[model samples]
Target: MAQGNERKSKLLGSGDIVVSFEFFPPKTEKMEETLWSSISRLAPLRPEFVSVTYGAGGSTRERTHATVTRLLRETDLKPAAHLTCVDASKEEVDAVARAYWDAGVRHIVALRGDPAQGAGTKYEPHPGGYTNAADLVAGLKKIANFEISVAGYPETHPESPSVEADIENLKAKVDAGADRIITQFGFDNAHFLRYLERARAAGIWVPISPGIVPIHNFKQVSGFAKRAGATVPSWLARRFEGLEDDPATTHLVAAAAATEQVMDLVDEGIKKFHFYTLNRADLVYAICHLLGLRSARTDASANAA
Candidate 1:
């Protein structure tokens, strides 16, 4: 076990923490406006890279492509496009990977997405599709030398029969050429630490970036957690207690909660994070600022002068 003072010193010391944000492609014009507004607000922060999420079973395939291509053309930010092997055949999936490569997107978040039937349902791979994430990773590698990031589950994946099995699956993805692991959002810092230890013990050496979702709406996030198999601890529930009637207070509480969570991870020696931004930037921006991230626009303006 690490000494308490050692952990504290590590947290207090300077480290270059890399951050990335995830946004889903919008489904409608109003939502598209909101999504771009949020993207513009966060683009100035100079995140390591921003990712656009693909919907289940390639539901948002076209929209996700449009969003990613726009980011490529208009922004100074690096974009990571998400690709999943849920409903598409191997040929179709490979075509998409080739398209992204030709479009100059060099990073991908590879996932074995949830069933099109919805959460908690059994996943049936398409007869001609890549069977799982590892297979998809290998397929993408064949198409291009893309940097691939695969999902990790601190709380075992719902379909995983055991934690040991889940680790093995993660190892398979790594072996298949994944570049990094971006975990599913987790509330408890201890869970992430333990998961990291387990991954190391299993001989997986890729950088595992902890996913952080600042709780803008407790009820909504709780539902998401339930579906994703992340545990919302009692302590976390208590923190949001009685704030339902006040949006202002909820936002403040959410920022503080998320900031503290990240700080604790920093104390434990983590230096990278992936934020699930949910198409809203205020809370994520505030938390990033608290973590000492400054807008690159400031430097750009000074340089221009």
Candidate 2:
């Protein structure tokens, strides 16, 4: 893979890559400051759109609304709000979608979110609420013309009975009018490629974006991967070995590991990506630069001054 760097460079020079980013709303004032700072740093790269995550059971509904609305009012970037079918009646969920529409947000990431109790717990849909993501997508389409994106799992979802069932579930979402699918974050590129092939064979023709998470903290990411049912390859674990106590060295290794993953995907002719930024920008910004994405705003400023 290291030997393909030159080829990756050549491909990036052709300028067809499209990227988006995902962020979680902040829970406090200090965290809010950090979130905006990260947003400011990344906005110059001009992502296709940036998405704000909805918390479990709609816990962060108000915060998510505030963050997304701020992006609409303050930035040139397009914002996609995540809406879920958990713990709320259909009327209530529809109201939120209406609010987003009135606020000038036209894109949504519709999801059948995790159970409010926790991840491993069984998901019990609210009485009279949309039963699942497919249902939610249908409801949102009825409300307005939203460019909707839904989740995909390269490794089948933990709660799903089988891979076949998971694919069927995805098909249902597409049938209900989802515009695209962004898969769960994964460490192994082979798994993602295989999943894409399976999705295409099943007649899902929409674009499927591979989700990338640059590991800022390997231990924390490992815990998340376990709950999300994504496998962390053993070789990936060894890459961060002995760097647990060294933040500086860990950042370098994290950047390199993520860069390699995206470049390898590029070598496979994947042109679109969605990054789970975890509310920081340095690593993602660095990776975008390595992919030959320079800030158009930066270049304009230099020319003007």
Candidate 3:
């Protein structure tokens, strides 16, 4: 029998999984309403934690703080606020970290942010800032015993001259007291698997959660992937082709592709996942359901309280 036709054992019944989500701060009142609605919808699945994103050059600092604070005040979800070393002095950055600590925010997703001009532009460390993510991680550790999650690039960061350099940089962050690593989202599972092996070989053993982005919109997401140095595989592109004018069909393909990716990863013994939710719920909720996760009464009860 051809290998393609060979039957394989079932892989979808595994309910043992840990998941987290990432959402950006809202810029307007209507956007804020939409953000909270999505939060309410996904709250029942009980994500391990949900993260709120910071804008470039720390532009959305206040909004990110507001969103995170609301999560702590109103929901049962653990919120991780993103902190970046971008266009701010060490003193300025540390003060923000201290505020998060005082606000009951414990986990931080730290990154050496993109250039102020935006991604694909040159990034120069601020003269008085922590210099880079590794330095920022160590600085954050000193300020508080916060749980720090750092970024990892599976296909190599665009600025890095080679993949080896990126791994070394990841190691520096790990050595600087980062507790976890969440990768840039990518569509290729093989790249992620190989990155896992390389990270293990390099002696960085912290939990590295693979980042999953459900294709809320394929074209927009592909643009994001290009900016963040992640790959948008041609085969994955083909799945979305011709669906541009048909959003309903596009959504169906998106669900199937994301489900297929996670199922394959589960077969490889990966149990932790971090999703770039883009502030949408129905797609992510259904994906979680197909993965055998169900809403817990306690989660919603806490929200009601």
Question: What lDDT is reached at residue 217 by model 2?
Answer: 92
Candidate 2 per-residue lDDT over residues 1-305, each given as its tens digit: 43544565456742578899999999999999999999999998889999999999999999999999999999999999999999999999999999999999999999999888985589999999999999999999999999999999999988999989999999999999999999999999999999999999999999999999999999999899999999999999999999899888888999999998988898777889999999989999999988888887877887899
Candidate structures ordered by lDDT, highest first: 2, 1, 3
Candidate 1 residue runs with Cα over 4 Å from true position: 1-15, 300-305
TM-score of 3: 0.93
Candidates in order have lDDT scores of 0.91, 0.93, 0.90
How far residue 243's Cα lies from its native spot in candidate 3, in Å, is: 1.0
Residues 1-305, candidate 3: write the lDDT tens digits. 11233312143443487889899999999999889999998888889899999999999999999999999999999999999999999999999999999999999999998767875578888899989999999999999999999999999988999989999999999999999999999999999999999999999999999999999789999999988888888999999999888989888899989988886787777888898989988788888877777788654676899
What order do candidates take by TM-score, descending?
2, 1, 3
Give the top-scoring candidate (TM-score).
2
Q: Which 10 consecutive residues of model 1 have the lowest summed lDDT?
A: 7-16
Clash pairs, candidate 3, are none
lDDT of candidate 2 vs native?
Answer: 0.93
Which of candidates 1 and 3 is the stronger one according to lDDT? 1
